[model samples]
Target: MNDLRIYIHIPFCKQRCSYCDFVTYDDKSYLMHSYFKALDTEIALNRQYIEKSNITSVFFGGGTPSYPDAKFIKAALNKFDLAEDAEVTIEANPGTVDFEKLSIYREAGINRISFGVQSFENDMLIIMGRIHDRSMAIRNIKDAKKAGFDNISIDLMHGYPLQTEEGFRNSLSSVVDLGVTHVSCYSLKVGEDTPLQSMLDKGLLPEIDDEKDRNMYKAAQGYLQANGYIQYEIANFARPGFQCRHNIGYWVLDEYLGFGAGAHSYYNGRRFSNITVLGEYIRSLNELKLPEDYSETIDMEESIKEFMILGLRMTDGISINVFSQKFNRGLYSVYGNEIKDCIDSGLLISNGEKIKLTQNGLDFANKVFRKFI
Candidate 1:
């Protein structure tokens, strides 16, 4: 049986963050019941795939999964025949969940909770338009532990407007002190059409300097590594044996099925995603039709390129033997010149069995990724 991973997107949030451009609705709480019904229908419609696969992971990612009732999460999970040790995770916001709600989620089989604690500084949180203050963030982390989550992850951001290197380090220290098992630190990017971009345009927020961003990134890497967290992926760090398996599956190109609005899926070399708009997703499901907006089969060349790009995201990099076995082509035969160029530029290093990014390459990851593209 195929080892399948499942992702369910909850497209409801109490409010949108300044830097977010994801497909989420801030005022759609009233549609919660109908949306859950549509999701259940979508799951039932995909029952054939579910039965033949050993569902190994389930992730509830979203606008704010904790904003809705935990029972809705349970309702979606009931449709799958999960493996005995599935890594079930839910993404939550700090201000939305309490001890009782989180405890109920634990009972509903959520083994991991990833909180969106962007920064521990109240000023930075305010700048980012986060709903929770630093105190609430700390309280939520403690409550997650009290509610029986041994595996916890929190996201921290750096390189944003008004955020100093010292402030970023302080946030990292606070997360480490919280004793969470995993940490994902992302550098803030001012995405186009986001409120952050508008602020930058109007000079309401200072433009982040490239050199400062790099320095902050290096600081985070150094601090986390010294504090017993292993840099398993470029942006993710974890204690021993606590790396996120679901995210690792994505890096390794595992077959995954995504449900609900705006969710994407990859199975048997085919890639597809559901409709992004909530109303359209619900309408299609209510009419007994699949809400797919796009689908395509990945060809050999595209697959090889994706393998290199995604696998290279991991700190351990890609295995040459596995690549050869999968594609029936030696890695060097196809991209020997590119690999040689990257190595000569000190962007990549190879110890014969595998190839991975060097520290400098991590700093210029976009430049390295562009080479493959």
Candidate 2:
């Protein structure tokens, strides 16, 4: 069986965050009945994409996958030929779900829970326009534990407006105290057209300083490392074997099928994305058609460049042996000059067969990535 991963996008949220620009809604509760029907259709239609493949992971990312209830999720559970021990994950928002809801999800086959706990500071949560406060997030964590969730992750954001180093430390410490299996720490990027961007444009928000962001990132790495978590990916830290396999599949450039509005998929060297509108997605799927709004078949050269960039995102880096075996070309011959440039500038280090980013290289990773482009 071909190895593949599955992603289901649940685009409904109780309320949208200020910095979020993802396709999602707050008034879609009434549409849940129809939404599940559409999901059922989409699942059946896309079964061919993962045909003869043992689905290794199933991820429910969102707005908040747990918002519509576990019944909505259970409706589509049996549609795919998932592996017996598939790693099924769902993102939950605090104050929107409780131990009862989490138990229902566990019964419905979700084994991992990622809570969107941006910070442990109530004031910071309010400034970020989050619907739930720090106490609510803590409550949800405790509830998930009571509900028998062992693989729980927390989504943390740093470098928010007016956020200090001490505040970031406190946030990380809280998660460490709770003994979360995984933690994804990301800096606040005010995406275009987001409410946070608008506030910044109007001088109502302070700019997130780059130095502060870097400091917090480094601090998180140190804190998590001390707490027995490994920084396996750029922004993700995990305890032992608890790294998010679903996301790891993406970084490793493995084939995966995506369903629902605004979800993107990559299979057979082609990339496709569904329409961002929920109604449009359902309408298209209702017509027995895939809701692919845009797609691209990556060319050879572009594929090689992408392979290098994506592989470098992981701490294990890229293996020269694997590159040669897969592409039948010497790694040094293909991008010898680029590799030499990066190594000479202390952005990349090579240990004969494998290459990885240095500490300084990680700080300026974007610049290094651009070199391949």
On residues 220-334, what C-alpha lDDT tens digit does candidate 2 reach at each position?
9999999999988788999999989999889878898888889899988899999988888889888988888999998778878988888888788899999998788989999
Q: What is the C-alpha lDDT of each candidate?
A: 0.93, 0.88
lDDT of 2: 0.88
Candidate 2 RMSD to the correct structure: 1.2
Error of 1 at 235 (Å): 0.3
Query: Local error of candidate 1 at 116, Å?
Result: 0.5
Best by lDDT: 1
- Cα lDDT for residue 315, model 1? 94
- Which window of ten consecutive residues has the lowest lDDT sum in model 1? 187-196
Assess candidate 1 and give its lDDT.
0.93
lDDT of 1 by residue, 201-274 (tens): 99988899878888988998999999999999889999999999999999999999999899999988899999
